[model samples]
Target: MIQSVRQTFNQAFSPEHYRAFLDKINADFPGQLDFRVAETPVFVPKVLTDKLLTACNDIVNVITRSDFKTLTEQAIPEGQRVPNEDDHTQFMAVDFAVCTDESGELTPQLIELQGFPSLYGFQPYLADQFRANYPIPENLSHLFSVANNAEYLERLRQMVVGDCNPEEVILLEIYPEQQKTRIDFTLTEKFLGVAAVCLTKIKKEGRALYYEKDGRTIRIRRIYNRLIFDDLQHYPDLKTDFYLTDDVDVEWIGHPNWFFRISKYTLPLLKSPYIPASYFLSDLTDYPADLENYVLKPLFSFAGSGVKLHITSTDLDAIPSEQRSGYLLQRKVTYEPVIQSPDGLVKSEIRMLFIWPKEDERPTLLTNLSRLSRGEMIGVNFNKNKDWVGGTVCFFEQ
Candidate 1:
């Protein structure tokens, strides 16, 4: 983290400015934000930025390798490949932690990587609002490239949907109104002119999926899928005519299989200074002596549902041998409370956004999302009742 910029922002910060910022946001989209917008932004320095990009390349090398399919098949489910798919994912996000190395220099460690979609619309829009209200320095930019928020989002849209009309592509989620990330869905619809259709709302006829918008039927050709099968299991009674596992004519903007394949399971295989030590439960020949220094995480669980922070032997023994294969033990990296708060320092985590264009050769870092926390963990529940700790983003040099 950049200490000078962090100190300057906090010293010059005003409650009135934040209130104006919120008012501007609500005026644009009323009732869109909850009480979480008042938190501080995560300031990422150049050193951590460079390290994160380097760590990403290390993982990308593995993903694009010749034996990558074989390596991925070690954990990925069989018979799930999209028969004859070629270059479908147009967006990718790799999250990293700003951690201190043995030499005490702040460096990035890879936490997780995904070839999936992110909050492309809201982040850039929010950045502009931040710049308007806050006293952001001339050198610091909310965007990664020379392109502004609109240009970047349009580029992403062109990469994902191509020449297809925006009306034909729908951002599909499972009961989006009930989702925690409904704000992102709404923002995406506003930017892309696509509706956020619930999975249950989709009607299947033959091999095509369609959804009704304003009582008019619209054929869904490209699906920007945000549904996770793990979450779908929660609502057993919910019915859907369109199924992901079924062979459908719809082209996926972010393929579903990659979510399961490149998630926490890949953490163990990735070697980087920015990534902490991770190991699959089944593959460990000997137990680590410092077991308390690690956290037990289910490879496929979303959010933090099945994570055990204070890990114990009894907890591991309780799981059946077959089920143990689905879990992993990740070394706990202390999130340094570097950002100065009114009371004390706050901890932060950076979510890096990337766009993999079909016409381009590699993934580009476009935008970012960050979270500031005062508690041990970075989630809302963990830092409840704490100040200056919630959803935020970084403004870096363009």
Candidate 2:
């Protein structure tokens, strides 16, 4: 963290301004934001930024290896693999827990990485609101791959809605309206011109997809997919015309297969000081002696689902041997409480978001989403009645 930036931001922060900020967001899109927006942004110093970039490149190197796909073949559940997955994922998000090294200096430890999209649409808008209302230094930029917001949006447009009319490309989700991050859907349409279309409403005819818009039906040319394929299990009772695995005439931006191939499943393949020790539960012959220092995680779950922070040999043994492959045994990184909140210091988790065009060889880190937590981990359940704890953006020193 930049001490001067933090000091000035803290000095300029006011409850009234924060309230006004919330009011402005609500007024712009009433009742769309179900998640809390943290009161302040994280000011990341260049040293830590450089380290984070190194950690990212190390993991990306593994992801970009020639035999990466062959190694992760079993990652995709047998019946869940989608049709016509691309050569690579168009979007990727890597999470890091801010921690202190042995030398007592700030360092980023890899928590998890996903070849999936994050809040690519809303992060820049969130940064703008913070700058407009707060005393943020001009040198600190939230974007890296591009110069400004307009260029960033253009990059997204080229990747997500390329060659086709905006109406022909949809942000596919299970129920776009019901998702908590609907604010992003609204913003995506505003900037990218792609509308959020629900899966249930898709009309499929002879392997072609179409969705009803304002007055007529529009053929789908591309899918900026946001739907988690596993979520379809929740609505098994409901009938749908289009399924993810169905052979459809469309381009998939964030191909569903990469979500699993590059997840906790790939963690064991990475070798880096920033990446904590990770092993598939099914692959472990002998449990570590210090099981207390590790956490158990489901290989494919999101938003902190089925993650056991504190674990033991007994806990590991309880999982059926046949089902162990679905889980991951990961060394836990001690989160250093570093963000100076109003009442006390809070731990921060940074999710570095990247976008890779179809033609690009590697994904480009564009922006970030930082979460402040005072609880055991970063999520909604961890901090219920907490302030300065929730979704936020990071201003990296240029």
Candidate 3:
């Protein structure tokens, strides 16, 4: 974080301007946003930006390990492993808390990493809206390895739709119309020509998958997968012809197996100065004496579900040894409230988004998204009736 940049942005920030920014977003894509947009974009200086990237690379080292798949073989639960997993994930998102170290210097600590797609379709647009609506510094840009938004969208087109006719590549979701992230799906369609197809609507004949659109049935050649099994499990009674575990004929972007392999399950496998001390609950013979400083997280849950901020030895002992493998004990990283808002400082969590083309050796760091929070954690439930706190992008100092 840059103090000077933050000060300048805060001094110039006005509620009226924020109102207009929201209005512009709504006008551009009416009712597409289901989540709150933070009033400001984070101004990250080179020091913290470099640290974030370094932390990402450190975690990626584990994901890219030669035997990563073999090591995480048990991560995929029974009846959950999808068929035809690719050599590597097409997308990865690594989250970090902007924290202070023992020396009181601002540093990044790994929070969670996922081998899944984030708001890739909408982040660039939001970043540009921040630029158009405010006086963002000339030296900062939200993009990486590209010159501008156009180039970024071009790269997205290549990764998501490839050379196939856009209609043949669908952004697959369980129910495209209802997800909170449907805005990104709409934007993806607008920019890349790929339509969002619901799993229920997909008609499967043998190994081939097809979805109806515009009075015609379209064959699916590639799938930009956005559905996760956790959501699908919610509707157990719903019948779908095309199941994720089915060995479909279509290629997958963001294969389902990687979601399990590179999730919280991989935390214990990572060893980095930037990463917090993490261990599988099953492997810990003795619980830490200071259990208050560690967070108990379920290996399979998402969106902060099944996480206990405070725990005791008794709590740890209560879990059956057989079920302990499904949980993780991670040293807590204190979030530093650094972003200077109008009334108070706000803590921020930045998720570094990356894309790995089929031919690439590693994921390429692109733009990033940051969540501002005045509550205990980063989510709508925690930050109720909060301002200057929600989903937003980061402008890294060049």
lDDT score for residue 247 of model 2 = 83
Quality of model 3 by C-alpha lDDT:
0.91
Q: List lDDT for all candidates, in order.
A: 0.75, 0.90, 0.91
**Which whole-number lDDT from 0 to 100 does residue 348 have in model 2?**
95
The residue-level lDDT of candidate 3 at 370 comes to 94
For candidate 3, the C-alpha RMSD (Å) to the true structure equals 0.9
lDDT, candidate 1, at 198 = 89
Summarize candidate 2's per-residue lDDT along 199-272 as a digit string, tens digits: 99999999899999878989999999898866777887878999888988899989988888888898999999
Give lDDT: candidate 2, residue 150.
94
lDDT tens per residue, model 1, 1-398: 56787777787787776777778888987766663764466667777677767887887766666665556665555544543244534677787766788788777766667766777777877777777776677677667764677688787778667788888998888878776677777788887777788888889899888999888998988888787777778888887897777778877777787776667877877777677899988887676889999899988777677788898877887888888888999998777767787778777778888776655666677888887877767778888887687777887643
